[model samples]
Target: MSSTPTTFDVRADFPILSQTVHGTPLVYLDSGATSQKPQVVLDAEVDFLTRANSAVHRGAHTLAGEATELFEDARATVSGFLGARPEQLVWTSGATFALNLVAYAIGNATAGRGPSRFALAPGDEIVVTETEHHANLIPWQELAARTGAVLRSIPVRDDGTLDTDAAASLIGERTRVVAFTHVSNVLGIVNPVAELVALARTAGALTVLDACQSAPHLPFDFDALGVDLAAFSGHKMLGPYGVGGLLGRSDVLDDLPPFLTGGSMVTTVTLDEAHFLAAPQKFEAGTQPVSQAIGLAAAARYLEGLGMDAVHDRERTLERRMMAGLREIEGVRILGDASGVERVGIASFDVEGVHAHDVGQFLDDRGVAVRVGHHCAKPLHARFGLTASVRASTSVFTTDDEIDVFLDALAGVRPFFGVGA
Candidate 1:
């Protein structure tokens, strides 16, 4: 065996990458939306379902015991992936639910259910960024409305970077919560997480990080990042869909009430009163996604084998190549910090005159896959003075040839649409 760490092959492990689209070989570039699953991840779920299928943490049978062990082991693997403890991770449907879980739980606490640590009253402020995905934005928007707190935002600079000076001004003593994305799905730019976390800490405010984009592309250490809470999706990281994680400081979790309450999340219940379980269990109610959790654990193990530093280096190289090629194309304007700002392997952009949907369709016709439109980030789009844009994001499996094909297809979009030279 070679002493060097094994580098993953972009083409061999993923079966879907072998197929064709419209009689041409497929070049999948839309991993920002959802990544294609590897054979191992698929096999893990199938293996669990075929042998140990049962309700977890609520049954006494042999299958149940096996399922429970797998489920808890997944929790441990995922926690290790994010530099968190197993007990600090809460299972949710996806990042959307994880974020909403935080918002609603804070709202629950505000409604006089728990300690004031998670509560928000009138005149308190919630700060987010102008570049946040709707998943990160709308929850805090509703939270402000629910708690009579004010909603403020950090401004986006011309290059799609956050204005830290503006953030310093916006996040003051009255700021109850400072929620921001670790990376912009649209801009592909990494935010200043440590700086923001420090500011929030100084203000005595809670910090919520949207880590959906970062966890897959970067080396993440949630505890070291020093945020009060964070959320990420499993599917985006090459795991099974319908499973994600919400990680929080134990004290914060203990302070907030449960967002969804029912079976398996409580200690005792009477007709008029109910006692809930501890931090994670209190947050996870009803039947959980057992097979998906097992598959996510498999994905975590796979990523660990690859080593996150190696993964980040590979994706960043591909991203730089992608940006350079896109910049060479006439009338193709890469959005957000195109001057090689620190970013992941994501690139969203607008053509000179053609609409983004048309560009996406043209790319699709050429056997290239990419995401189009606002990407659930309307405010960021409006800031760029457009309603939509084309996005091509990369994964560890993306290749040099694939990126070259995408660039060739993109170069033809404007001319095909009869746009300016």
Candidate 2:
């Protein structure tokens, strides 16, 4: 380890990884879906539930006040993660819910129900990239269909990259909203966010970023990144499964109507007229994820203590090694190389003569875990002429020894299937 204490010891934390998988030592590489919970994050959640369990934001009791303070402090912690104002963050169930909130709210605005600022109409176009996860794609497709607007996509190149020149041309005056992924879940391709944001700004479109992949392992600044809104999941960042966030500029968030509303969002209510509270509270209507939010806050602090840059550096090194090793396999083809662009530690590939499920099982039998499927990017798979692929993703705690075990397991995969030289 270097003099800097950024080193991650695999056996030190993560109780789950300490056990054997199928009677073999475990090798976990599926961080693209969700990361393993560290002891600190687990301890935080347990502490909150055991001691400070109560409803937040609408109570006067001691436990209530403590819960409220921790919940808001969690909001502040996540806000600091993205370099946004704490009040600018909205708590949702997860990344999917966060994406749906924006989609539904934008759909409401298009139907003349939300604030007038988001009034997308007929003949308007919404642009998305072919590489986007369904979380970022299908919602806009539904919005475009509902509004009678055109749904356009920036086509991915042969190497699974968006043709930015094509994106500049396709995002015309009629483009009302442009949504894209900051990093691809399947391909490990980090899109050109600043360039795309500039183009969207030029086209007078609202830009929504799906930062579900980038937020966990990279340094993020929603404002400096020039995104109107960005969404991420707590589970992917080493927290529990059911907490997520949507970070937006305060003014833009203020414009959107609440998607899930019941009790706590209202300021005043009448038979036919209702007024909602301000940005964060308005969007977070019901009893929020009190324990999960606090868990995610601790996860955020855990990552912060590790430092985002160090995390990025460690993951980048692992990704390069993983990519190089995977490519050396004769029948394996990686999805996107990105042509030297910076990316995180997610990588997807396909074996020429093996089904992705079989590949996944083969790897699993040897104690290596990976994700295998379209990865919720069906259109992206079609773009690459693939039905499914095997994805291996890593995080800060992933060690080179684990990768070596993974590579050794993967080397035998083709021979077992009779598909290799």
Candidate 3:
């Protein structure tokens, strides 16, 4: 909370942050939803569209060759950012698509379509954590429903950390997949990935990570984390929308069958039978998100230049400031245990006797934008005995002054609503 200068002073890179909302400068605290795009990301997409917009891997023409090189180069850049190789990455519309691809591919294998290791039988278990976002939860639910497998969850403690003992017991011989989030979107708690992965490995289960919240804030290295597969979104990491990646070990990706099959993914296609290509290409069907991929690579390079370690350090300071300020306010209860836990710059809290939407409106009127509702984390909200809460999340560009503005505005929520006065 000391007025020490921020480690990152790159707010000017994001053009949207310069704008006014409700006659006040915009204070964006909703990075958990989507980060505002920087000028470099915007320019990258436009540059591709203007100079090398063509169908990649389709033609022998000059534009197509240039586009294909840029697209594959983008894959390399993004994959390298996460400690993965280019062949280990598959492009998708977003993290939702990536997660679904893994689930459906496993379902296909269960249906006698792919490798035996991925096949799940009735009574087999797919374990997830209670703090999962619906994007990570619902897909596994549907996969279980389709394959007659059992869906189980590791409960969160009252302090919002996962019960590791519960996780150890839940992932037993019956477990086929142990999917969890790297960071809880609602609570901002950084989960113990290595320990969970160890348990899954011991149980002979596949580890799938929802890295949407972690990849942007932490020093992320998928291979180093030892997860079998991971998913992340570009829009969540200062990049363009409509693009993300599914990263996996080479052997795992090679063993899984294609979830979506059509043109651009096939090696041979007859009227009756079709043969698909290798890992990354096999999963990528039809036209890809060409411009968005270019933009995302640019975004990755931008973060690389800033250094993820420095970014993490800066956000930690902001999180401390935000959390400490929230605790001092009467009638405000932070959703999770904020003490002695590693988290990003995110704090979700409920104001006593005030609806989260009303709180959102009060902040929005003052140009302090934050996220409200369950944040696609209904089960986590239910665990806290609430339906929704207000979440203020930060990014590299977020200033400490913005955090103060949000806290000052939030202090008056219950008073302005004529409650707890």
Among all candidates shown, the one with the greatest TM-score: 3
- How does each model score on TM-score? 0.97, 0.97, 0.98
After superposition, candidate 3 runs with Cα above 4 Å error: 1-6
Candidate 1 residue-wise lDDT at 117:
79
Cα lDDT computed for each candidate against the true fold: 0.92, 0.88, 0.95
Question: Please, what are the lDDT tens digits per residue for candidate 1 over residues 1-421?
Answer: 2334334675788889999999999999999999999899999999999999999987699999999999999999999999999999999999999999999989988988878777898999999999999999999999998889999999998889999999999999999999999999998999999899989999999999999999998999999999999999999999999999899998888878899989989999999999999989999999998999999999888888888888888888888889999889999888885564678999999999898999999999999999999999999999989999999999989988899999998999888888785
Quick one: RMSD of model 1?
2.1
Model 3 whole-model lDDT (C-alpha atoms) = 0.95
- Give residue 70's lDDT in candidate 2 (0 to 100): 94
Give the Å error, residue 203, model 2.
1.2
Sort every candidate by TM-score, greatest first: 3, 1, 2
State the lDDT at 233 in candidate 1. 98
Candidate 1 at 165: error in angstroms? 0.4
Between prediction 2 and prediction 3, the one with superior lDDT is: 3
Model 3 Cα lDDT, one tens digit per residue, 1-421: 2255347778889989999999999999999999999899999999999999999999999999999999999999999999999999999999999999999999999888999999999999999999999999999999999999999999999989999999988999999999999999999999999999999999999999999999999889988999999999999999999999999999999999999988999999999999999989999999999999999999999999988888888899999899999999999999886578899998999999999999999999999999999999999999999999999999999988999999999999999999986
Candidate 1: where is the Cα deviation over 4 Å? 1-7, 338-340
User: What is the clash count for each candidate, in the order shown?
Assistant: 0, 0, 0
Question: Clash number for model 1?
Answer: 0
Mark the regions of model 2 whose C-alpha exceeds 4 Å error after superposition: 1-6
